[model samples]
Structure formats: structure tokens, C-alpha cells
Target: MTFDRPHDLLKRSPANPLIVPEQVRPSRPDWRVDCAFNAGVVQVGDETIMLVRVAESVAASAPGELRVPLLAEDGAGWRCTVESLRRDDPAYDFADPRMVVLRADPAQVYLTSMSHLRLARSTNGTDFTIDDAPFLFPSTRYERFGCEDARITAIEGRFYINYTAVSDLGIATGLAVTDDFRRVERLGLIFSPDNRDVCLFPRRIGGEYWCLHRPAPRHLGTPEIWIARSPDLLHWGRHERLAGAVPGGWEASKIGGGAPMLETDRGWLQIYHGVDAQQRYSLGALLLDLDDPRIVRARLGRPLARPAEPYEVTGFFDNVLFTCGATIRDDALYVYYGAADRVMALGTVALPELWAAMGV
Candidate 1:
């Protein structure tokens, strides 16, 4: 629960940080570039499609040793990271450059870091027009440590991405398919290591193919919300546990699955992400069972968005707001948060006054 930075919303974005970090490397070290803060969005044709997850850093010739790098860009802007240190096993150690894991030697440890899932375009969603190439990367093997966030969905017409692969053998959940995002059809890791905050459930009930996961019970407790069933979205099963964590309220400290639910007649309206116990991070809501969406009818004690602006408190991991994606055209509800992971912010409510202040 310690946070500090130059903050004031870092870049504040009149432009520069809507998403920056073009592409940097040992090209001399010290200009700054780091990305990936939950991404995925789609509207297609008329424009409005992004799938970012870009992170880049490099500097570690010897002294103390440190070199962080990651890339994956597609928006007429090219940048890719990962040449291969192949898990440099001088013995193995790197839980984020020395949080502690030991044993490094796979030819001098230079994997740098890798991730892929890029493609940005917009027709006034907030000025953007990129795409020189790179729609998906990290070609399998559970993705050699690349690709994060992404939860597009789309269904019926076909778009169902799932993202978050990462490697060395952990964070898995990859599957892809497209109609014409320029042809992509890879379906590998369905949901492996410890699971992630999945999505999908734009439509489909008794017929199957519902989703919304977050299976990390590391300490053997907390971090809940589950529900599966996929006749073919990649073979999931009936596991249910719709929601949890609300002991003292404001989401007691865990919850996930945001954007991509909104239907609201009185059901299927979700907008998760809540944390407290000092972790901060906010935004919450639930009201399922539009046909047994694992049945959690009402929820929302407080927090339709917290971490009071100033770009949600600070940077790199401060108060945090963290949203994967959002959009609701007309009556407004275009929240695309990420602020505090570094940048990116666009707030709006009035979607029936934010679900009537989330007290439905």
C-alpha cells in the first residue's frame, strides 16, 4: 500500500499518453517506454478497434544487471520484442528482475521480455489511426511470454479473442478467431495456469458458451467469480461461482470481469473490478441471471468508479482503476480506464445515470 510518483496523472494526455512508448531498446537506454494495462475493444468498419499491450524497456550491460523490454505494435507503427534468451538458465532467477527466483544462465539471460497483441484504429473515438501490421504474435508454446489482457468477445459474427498467454509455464488462456480483423485463427491454450479474468457472454445461454473467470486462489482463499460452459468457444465446462468478496462492502478486496456484459432490462449488466484492504482500485456492479448467468442477481454496495481522478491517483501502479475495455454509444458509458498503470483514461457515466448509481 505504498505509492508515489511524479503523478498528476503522469502524461495527462492532451495527446502523448493516450498510449505512448513507441519502441525503445538498448538503443542507448533512458528515454522510457513501458506498456500493457488491460486492453481490447472493437466496433469494426466504422472504426474503433484496439488491442494494445505494449511494454518496452532495456538497460543492463552488467553492473547490478537489469534490462526490461516488451513490444507488439500494429497501427502503421511497428515494434516487436523477444529475440530469445530461451529461459537463460545460468540456474534460473527472475520474478521480475530480483523480487527473487535465482538461477540465470540460458546464454547470458537476454530474453528482455515479450508480449504481442496490437492493432489500433479509430474514427473519432478519440483520434487514432494506426496499423502497419501485427494483429497477434508470440506464436504458441503457450505463447513464449507475450500477450496480455484482451477479451474482445463479438460472437455470432466471430471475434472471440481471449488473450493473456505469458510463459515459462504460468498465466495461460489463449484462443483466437476472426472474421476479418485481417484473418487470425489460432486456438491453443484454452485456460491453463491459475486462470485469468476471462469474459465472453455477449450472448448465449441455455445453448452454452458463457464465460467470466478469475481463478487465482493462491493463498487458498479470496479472488473469486467463476462460471463456465462452452460447447465450442474452446471446450470449457459447467463450473459455477458467479461472485464473491464483499465482506465489509466496496468489494472487500477482489473481483474481476469488466466491460462486455451490459444489456440491462434488469439483468446481465456487469462492470466489475473492486479492491480494498489497501489495494485501492475501484468500480463495481452486478446483476446476472438473464438466463442463469450463474445467477447472482444484485450487487453494488458502492464504487461505480473510485480512485478519484488526477488520472486515478498516480502511476505505474498507484490507486489504479484498471478496465479492460468499454463502449456504450448513445446514452453515454464510454469508460476506457487504465490510469495509474501509467496512463490512458476516458471517463463518462450517464448510462441511465450509471445504472442508477449502481444501486439496482
Candidate 2:
């Protein structure tokens, strides 16, 4: 029942927050970065690269104006259009600082700021050099609201990225392929609306590519992890429930895939995130069948990592420790996560120790 605390299994870097909003400049002059978090990490030669989600807010605007950015369909070209709503307007509800919703139309909600992915490179796993401009921005109508929580998997010498695309249609998974990180090709939306937290397996399984995703149902079932298969990576089918929240544990409310599943001798080592009833986020592990990833071999009853340190316990969102990706080198697993949804931090765990902690 009681598992070892996260601090015992995973060791937090003494440097703590490796990246923060002040460490990286905004992509544009008019925009100010509010937070830089939820980065997908990859190893390029000797460098550690992170595709970080940067949330930006516009400069001072007119009083009582709630400015929001959305993708514009002007027929000329793809661009960002800022829409302003008055705070005193009776039709709108601005009770949530994160988003604004229309009182008459509950389904219509808009984020307060625009989000984009940026690049940050580190020689060691701790300190980083962030790029001045955004590496990936909102281009298509599906990502009009923003592109967030990217997970990268290297397949056949090419890197394929799956990210959460947000819009009025809802949150969906979008795909991008790149031989080199310099130029990326957008593959459009792969999964439909109300689905997110998708991570594609690095290689094919049983002649079919596999992906782990979460589909959140509004009125019927709770949000749970699911697995889907595809032969060509575009059209996905054969959906099966992989895992769901445990009733009396840390992941009581919802669960989703975190990093891409890591292949090990025992099975497919999957690191995932779970939200408790209090909305606190933590990380856990799942051992899935190597031949048939749909079958869950074993799952950690308790979290492998959770918000413990001061940095992880406070910021944009409190008690949050979320990771999009991680890198394994030698005998150590380097976990790069978003701390409190405001900054990036690094945690290191020995492979043997982590396996032991998970009882694998």
C-alpha cells in the first residue's frame, strides 16, 4: 500500500529550476512570457534539447479589455488575431483567470494567453540555452488557440512529434515529422477532439505503430488512458482502454501518458502522470507487454515522483510536476519536467533504483 516517497526514488537536481520565464526572452517584442514549462526533451549528439511550451501575454492594453489570441482565417494567409472582450460585459464570465467563457454559451471558452513551443539546448542536463524565437507556432485552424505538451519519438532515424493542439473544437493530438529539428513538417491532426496526452511508440509493434492517448468524455465516462494502432501513422484505429484512475489513490481523478514508452528488457517502461482529487499532479510507472502493448503487465500503486520541493509546490499552478519526455543515458534516467507549470526542472534516477522502487 505505502510506497517509497518520490524523493527516495528520484533525486532532484540541486540547481532546481533549470529554466524559467526570465531566463528566456519572449518570441516577439510586444509579448511577455508568463511561463515556460512542459518541455519535451531529446538528446542530440552531446546536447540535450527541449521543446518547451512558452505562455505569453500581450503588453498593456485598454482598461477592462480581456485580450485573447486565436488563429485567423482571412484567406490571405495564416495569422494570429487578438480578440478583446470587456470585463464588465454581462454576456461573458471571466471568473477563471486562466480562461474566459461565455455565460450564454458554456461550450465556448477561450484561453487568456497564447502558447508556442520554443527550443532550449543544454550541454549538461541542468543549465540550458534557450532560443530567442519560437521553434513551433500555431499555424493551422486546429491549433488556433495554442500548441502544447509535445512528445517526441525517434522512429527510423527520423523524429516524429505529437503535441496537444487546442482550439474552439477542443483539445486534439497533432503530428509533425522532422529529419532535423531545423525544419519541421506539420502532418495535421491525427486524433480528433477531446483527445490529448498522446505519445507514439518509438517503433512498430506487431506490424502496427502504437500510440498512447487520453480521451476525456464530458457527460458519460471519466478521462482514461487508451491505446490505438496505425499502419501508416496517419489514420489510427483499434482503440482499447489502457489504464484509468485508481479510486483511492493519488491518481483518483484522471490519468494520462507522459513520456514516450521506454523499451527495457522486462517490458515497455511507461512513465505517466496522474491527478488526484485535489488536482495535484504526480508521476507513476506502468509496465506493458512488449509484444502487445495493449496489455498492462504491472502498474505502480503509488507515484514514482510528486510535488515535494518548494519549487515544485508553488508557481503558475500549485503542486504540479508534469513531464512530456525524458532521456536515458548510461544507467541514469534524466527526467525534465515542468515545475508548478511555471518553470523547468531536472530530476535524476538510477535505472536500477527506479526499477527497484517500482518493484519491477
Candidate 3:
């Protein structure tokens, strides 16, 4: 199958930003939604479900006060901390819009908003109905900061969710299991601090479970994707480097796993996201050996999807195209992605064409 544009393998939906912040009411009356993005997508019955990450900011009336939600010492709920700063405050540093840092002590930083997962459903894979209430929130000390991107993998008739849990300590991966989306069984933090983007394979391989994750260093090393194996889903081991950013491309800065791996006749087809020096994010692919997923069979030299459209190039965070979920149906791939870290969008590509493009 030949494509008109090689990099345009995925076709964006006309109904872009299927779900936005305005469509979802904040979990609390005093909070206003800032953005909704980076959702985990799955197919259930006849509907396509998305677990969306919704960031909310506190409604503030005070002129100079910044109220941020942080995990309370008890580790079960959130406590808002108010920081009043003046433009001339020598100790205050406001370089990043996402965070407020202390000039005197760089270690002291606070987030501008809090994020939680919300449920959205669509029957046609384009138009969606967003839930008013949050499906998952910062319920634990580890998740006190918030729960960001979620990746859902179905195995043995159950769905496993792996999400980034943020707190004062740093970022970690948290796991949850559900038979039905109604109730989730929390598995606490599976991967320790300084690690995230944990995506599990659908089934056991070589008599063990496998997962792809990114271990980000605080100061020294670059963020790259790694593969690990485990007998139980809770404890992971035997970590090995999967892929890294290739300098001078859209993925020069860092790369991480995107959607859950799709089993194909060629091998395990995995989609991942990469960021460049300019902080632009794009989607790429990798083919792994069926027997040993750690072995990379092939990789796409170029990105399959990039930030080009109006909605994709501008928003909360500009030039970002991140995805955590995708579903296969009727010989086509439905990819649900977060555009510019502000809203959810959908894209599609023929399955056989995608496989052919990979050249595996």
C-alpha cells in the first residue's frame, strides 16, 4: 500500500479534540478544568472508552496568591498550599508556567494545577461523551501530586492500568486492575521513583510478563525507553535499554512507549513518542521479537505522526503529540492521542499499510 505522504500514515479525525476541558466538569465546585489530554483508550462491547487526564486549577480570587494541591502528610488526600508572591520577591522564581520555583532553593517547586483521570466514551470513535465525575484521582500519598498518563492493557479477561504517579518525591509508576471499569484494585507503586511511562504487554511472553518503561534521571542521563520482565506484575526486573533518542531528529530529546503493543504476523508492533531539541513530540514505531520482546526486530526511521495541524501545534503545551492508547478494529488502527497537552484527538491508519510501512 502506497501513501501520498510517507509521514502522513495516520489520518486525523475531522472532529478533533473529541473531548475538551469544558466538556468535563471539575471534580470540585471550587476547581476549574484547565485541560484534558493523554488518555488511555480501550474497546469495550460496542464503545471506545478513554481514561483522560484532566488538569484542574483552583479558582482563586486573591490577586497574588497561588494555591497548589499537594499530597498531605497522611498520604490519603490532597491539601491546598497557598503561596503569596510579589513580582519583586527575591526568593520567588516564575520561569516555567507549569511550576513555581524558589530562587534561593531550587529544590522547592510547586505545580500550577492538579491532574486526574476522567472517563469518556464514543460509539463511532470520533464523537465522545465525557463523564462529569473523575474516574481516577489522587487518592494516595504517592499520587498526592496527581495521576498523569494512563496505559490500559487487557490480559486474562482483566484490564491492567499503569499510570504516572507524581508527588514531592518525584514521579513513579502505579498499577491498578479492573474486571469492569466500575471498580479498580490499586496495586500501589510498582516502579520506583524517577520512573514512568510503564506499558505492559497484553500477555505473558517466554513464561513471564513484559513491560516497557522510561527511567528518567534527575540531572545526569537522558530519558530513554527500557524493557523489563517479571513473574508477577508487581515486581519487575532484568531491565534493558529498548530505544533512545537519535540526535538531529524530532525525537532527539527523549522517547517513551505510546500505545500497548499490537500482535501482528510480523511481530509485536509498538508505537512510541519522541521529543526533539525544540520540544516537539512525534509518534514512531518499533517491532520486537515475539519470543523475546527485548530484542528489537526493526524501527521506523521516521515518525508516523508529527505536530502539524492547527490543534496539534498550539494549546496548553504546544507542538506535542502524545498517546497512551490505540485500538484495532476492522483492519484499521484507531489512535487516541493528546494534542498539545490540552485536548484529546483521534487518528486512523490501515493496519496492513502500517505493517507494510514498518518494513518488517
Could you list the CA RMSD of all candidates, in the order they appear?
19.9, 2.5, 3.2
Ten contiguous residues with the weakest lDDT in model 2: 1-10
CA-RMSD of model 1: 19.9
In model 1, state the lDDT of residue 350. 62
Q: What would the TM-score be for candidate 1 when compared with the true structure?
A: 0.31
Q: Which is superior by lDDT, 1 or 2? A: 2
Model 2: CA > 4 A from native: 1-8
lDDT of 2 by residue, 97-132 (tens): 678998764568889878899988888878898999
Query: In TM-score terms, which candidate is top?
Result: 2
Against the unseen true structure, what C-alpha lDDT does each candidate score?
0.66, 0.86, 0.85
Compose the digit string of candidate 1's lDDT tens values, residues 159-191.
878887876667778878888788888877778
Tens-place lDDT per residue, model 3, 112-212, is 78898888888888888888888888878788678999998888799999999987778999999888888988888999989988878999997899999
TM-score of each: 0.31, 0.95, 0.94
Q: Which stretches of candidate 3 lie over 4 Å from their true place?
A: 1-7, 74-88
Error of 1 at 355 (Å): 12
